[model samples]
Target chain A: MAFGIGSGIFFAHMPFLKLNGIPGTTYRVMPGLISKRLTNRLGINFQAESFGNNRQKGMDELDRVLDRGFPVGMLTSVYYLPYLPKAFRFHFNAHNLLIYGKQNGEYLVSDPVLDFTTTISPKDLERARFPKGVLAPNGRMYYPVSVPEKVDFNPAIKKAIRWSGFENIMTPPFLPFFGSRAINYMANKVAKYPTAMDERKAILFLGNIVRMQEEIGTGGAGFRFIYAAFLQQAAKRLDNPELSLLSKEMTGIGDQWRDFAFSAGRICKGRQAGNEDFKSIANLLMDIGDKESAFFHKLRKVKM
Target chain B: MKANEVPQDDSGVIGGKFTGLKYATDENGNYVEVQSIGWDAEITVLSQAWDEVNEQAKEALEKVKAGQWSTLAYHSTKCMMNEAMLSEYMDMSKAKVKEHLYNPAAFAALPAATKEKYAEVLNIDLNELLRAE
Candidate 1:
């Protein structure tokens, strides 16, 4: 599954990187990276371009691609996508959507977060594509020109798992903004929030953590459940019982991740859910960090 | 999570207009994709983040109203951006961005072309931007 092979599980709580004055806390890497990883694994021939400072060129290229009846993936600023529910449309610039066709000057869009496909006017699409800010897409459009047939899945699956292992567990711990170490690093930093910052700001940081974890298309727990589900499917396909066992454990861990979210929510909302405070919340993250480190370590050793 | 265990609570800020896809296991212990309406805890945290944005925007609006800062401060906060990002988006130096955001005089003295550029990037009309509200 793309979820496991995408190698996107990550953690960061950098005070330097500010998102609307809230300290940076992310659960994954850059957007669209999962599909990029999938394309690489599939050996698919894809053409992706960033039309910086040339909006019309990007639009013309998109029309040309769609005239050939190919769906194109576009990196956009979610805030400008009027088709999206507006209540939560922040200034995220890396949201990916598919543009399959143009009719009556509106581009037919298929966003992963939505249940049904939507349409965007050309002007709105241009704004979404060229919107400025951090991680701006610069009118990026990507589509696969060719996908090879008769490709084997075993090697791809193994390679992806190994890559995730290295990316998640084996990254050097000295770098405190990535991998299992970052999870621990955040856990430790979060414990100091109350003492280091104002109470309201500290709570806002916790709320930001939960928002970053569950927001968008992540299947909860910074994608632990999705990864578990991926492992289960891979187990059946590869006929490996060990992966299934790991999948079950991962599911349980995903449940723990949910526990962390719900408990943190209670604290943020000030609902007084059994005295669940910042220290306990930090402990929960520390626990998840330990389990994830162990899980990835075990995964690196599984004889695929 | 099992297929049936997928939360159907559509109580998020998105309301029920859209659904999110989540991965779950079926009765056969096989993986399946499930559509989730949303979850309450997720809603709580998400709303809190947005509320912070709204609060900061509200505070900046007050400052702009009091002539303490330029409308850029209010617009930047309302658009969920900060001084650095406003600079990055407008392609101006950080010092100028800070000056234009904090000093009404700097914002008033901006050239018409630069003001139009700011309006375009901020998704506001040139007239609305000139009105400083």
Candidate 2:
């Protein structure tokens, strides 16, 4: 079974039939394991080194490797990979990909995570973190070999190397933050109108609150509490001829739906459940809210 | 005539361009012209308070961008709703309502009012709660 597994792993790393006639070097290494099989096949002598489980050490190792004119490739856990420099260019969480390559005085990279390949100027690479400077104390660094050009580097390996440049790129602000900003912007807009449109404004505010809760995983509890308060306030300001019992009933139903969703499952778990799951749920909830908000926004436009 | 004394006319005819000259009779019976040039200056400085406010807002927006608000909201809600439910209930003022009503040793202690309200709303008590038992 072990031999079969080894053979399967080996064949998996081999270039497909299309790559057979292609020129260039190819190397593959599984995460957390040394690429002895790939090294033997390439007929290259390479050494493996690990930065003592911290970003600073990793950064230092990165500087040392680049200073010595040797290129480095890293394979690390998903959590650590995103925090590294040039993370967007590489798939730090994946099976196999290179992080750097050189062609015609330009360095090209293919990051599997971002699913994109780009060529960066030599100047940029020189200023790059892993290649030019020390790693953070908590960062991790892995290099396949200490020597340059000993292994026949294939396009796949080149692509993977190029891709690793995107490790630790900053992610954009999340949808929730945008939703909050949108809510605040809309609230300030509503506040400018006079007393005659107070009910309408309150309704719009409630609608936005609902939208925010739904879209950003802001949660039904907070929205429900706020909506209830808004409704009570709107009841005192009921001067509109259009305000009717049916409108209140509909709003009530919406609130009930939100409450049901909020209390539906074990929504409130402790820290032990893992942050990733919570983030996933928050993202999913935000997506749903954003869709709902879009529907309501269209409705509001039609009303206007 | 010497170049310096070529033409001292108030009229702009001596030069191709117009000139700022005023002619007057001198004590020595020679015509003299006075010329003057005008200049203006202005200065402005930005307010430090405005810059500080702008910087603060930018930092707040960045923190929001970094997912700080969402993280805080998630943790706060979890603490308030889940963990707080398992502890002994206390009043809004944090005063103990009853000996059995509030369990200081519970996983998440809460004020009596918040506990009672949550318990009443959630339909669970200390004995029936999973985290408490």
Candidate 3:
């Protein structure tokens, strides 16, 4: 997995978008952003391409890549990967994994969501790669066609820091559902769930938030830890002790996010006190939003 | 998020069980990457949350078997769409999609363009879509 130069860079800017009429919420990065950032920063020939609604063509491309000894990254729905435990299965179509090789009709998969590498039959893999939903994978995949023999980490880290900072702070507030504004937007909306929805529906909604934060791959805490890892790597690469200090601070912030998830989980299981209603949940989120806001503010001002 | 904290329980372990890398605190209390076995409490609730989704999908499939709903219902369930999302994908009104869910005969009478749209959105062959899955 590409850590420092991948999702880690976009950590603080990840947003939550709540549809006006839909019951679901999203806390994921938009597809293709990772490849875009990687390509730009690493100066590699990386392309995020889709197979144009043709399953057979997509499968052919996947095989062609594997034949070339290139591990192809694919977008897949979580529910169709039979190798996954039932407990971790969902209809989410944006889960990502890499197919590196095949043996005995089973593809070797490196799913970032999983703790270890696994194999899947081609039939089951096909079902996973083509599940229907918004932003359908349609056999979408990405890979770097060319990579420089030598690369510099310092400049790349600096670029990532600048882009991530700009994207988070400068995101248009009018969108109301993205960037920092999204945190408050979601918090306000969450505050009303207790009165607006029945007990069952309210619990479901809360459960969804926790799942978005903690489940479906790297829980929210994982993102923070990933970013901290990036900072630590960046610090070592650049020999910048300040960046090391920042990494520790980010780790602390990650702990806060974990704490929020734990609180939300308690509420979901009805283990919390009566006062831990929607308002309290919203308050917890607001606390997170505040800390993150301040963290990014300091991040943007850090001198390389 | 540390390696030591990665759960060892089987509840949310994805893709059969395997050990993977996790970040954990070292003796110095600083974070370092280490290999660890898998367990995630988040997956426990996540799996529980899907009960309602699976229930809805199963019910929709039953409607297909009973011939009260078209195979589109089953495909929609497979696609993890509710009526509103299906309506958006099929370009039909939500109420219209719900009506079709209850009246297979009416759905069968839909325009070719509408049927084709549903097939395309569901990523299924149009011919196969007309029949039961």
Per-model B-chain TM-score: 0.91, 0.20, 0.72
Q: Write the per-residue lDDT of candidate 1 for residues A51-80, one digit (tens) a residue.
A: 986889989999999998889998998899
Regions of model 1 farther than 4 Å from truth: A271-276, B10-12, B130-133
- Better candidate number, 1 or 3, judged by DockQ: 1
In angstroms, give how far residue A200 of model 3 lies from its true place. 1.9
CA lDDT of each prediction against the hidden true structure: 0.82, 0.30, 0.68
The candidate scoring highest on lDDT is 1
Candidate 1: pairs in clash: none
Q: List the lowest-lDDT window of 10 residues for candidate 2 chain B.
A: B38-47
RMSD of each: 2.3, 30.6, 4.8
User: Which regions in candidate 2 have their CA more than 4 angstroms from the true location?
Assistant: A1-30, A79-97, A101-109, A113-115, A118-140, A144-304, B1-133
Ranking the candidates on DockQ from highest down gives 1, 3, 2
* Residue B28 CA displacement from its true place in model 3, Å: 2.3
Best by TM-score, which number?
1
Docking class of 3: acceptable
Better of 1 and 3 by lDDT: 1
Q: Please give the TM-score of chain B in predicted model 1.
A: 0.91
Write one digit per residue (lDDT tens) for candidate 2, span A1-304. 1111111110011112111121111111133333543444445555555544334555455556656666655543222232223211211122233445466766554433333466644443322322211111222334445334554434323222122212111113342122322322323333332232443232232232322233211112223222222322333344322222322432443444344233212222111223343344444444434433443333223210
Q: What is candidate 2's CA lDDT for residue A218?
A: 14
